[model samples]
Target: MLLVPRQLLRAGMTGDVPYYGGRFSPAQAYAAAHPQPRPAPPPPAPTSRADQQLAALQNLFAAGVLTAEEYQQFAARVTP
Candidate 1:
């Protein structure tokens, strides 16, 4: 949102990282001309029930969808 970037967008000079504001960056346009399919990642090793619960809570907290107090409350439920 800086002045430079804002001006670039205004001038239609989108940078790297796919299309934005209905305009594709130079790299994105090139990529579109040549398509490639990436291999999917290997499945993760199975996790314990406790580990799964902890991960879920961590994701929610990291996304700021849960306050610290709410996080602690949910974490207690997962741990015990």
Candidate 2:
């Protein structure tokens, strides 16, 4: 296990361990000014009102809330 300089650590048997997020990191992890940019994640696909209704109908059928005939009729209105 890495250890922080005794001067940096509080007066205790254990030393101060550096952390990055929730995990430990080394004190030398950053030495100088640096910049690294990450691309943003792609946006989610947009959904149409018909598509939303279709998904709702499918869920209802899966949950046994809509009969097969009712689901088929509703699905026809949403699908091309």
Candidate 3:
């Protein structure tokens, strides 16, 4: 069995006296003041005609529209 004083319980729930006796612990306050920078988005994909053709061939191969042999043959043409 456990018992909590009503006033203390109310204070804890209403943020009058948080678990840490403050709005946040030292570490949490520091994190709120200084957040890490987010990584930049990845570079845009290549848009050259050959690159586009190669990507299209890859999609077709993935969808089973082009056989492995056909994909390889078309890719060779696009790359060189």
Assess every candidate by TM-score: 0.40, 0.38, 0.41
Off by over 4 Å in 1: 1-47
Across 1-80, the per-residue lDDT of candidate 1 in tens digits comes to: 37665656755654433446778878889999999988999999765898988898999999999999999998898786
Per-residue lDDT of model 3, residues 1-80, tens digit only: 44988897788788894467546898899999999999999999775989888889999999999999999898988886
The alpha-carbon RMSD values of the candidates against the true structure, listed in the order shown, are 22.1, 13.3, 11.2
- Ten residues in a row with the worst lDDT in model 2? 24-33
Q: How big is the positional error of residue 46 in model 2, measured in Å on the Cα after superposition?
A: 6.4
Q: Model 1 clash tally?
A: 0
> Which candidate comes out best when scored by lDDT?
3
TM-score of 1: 0.40
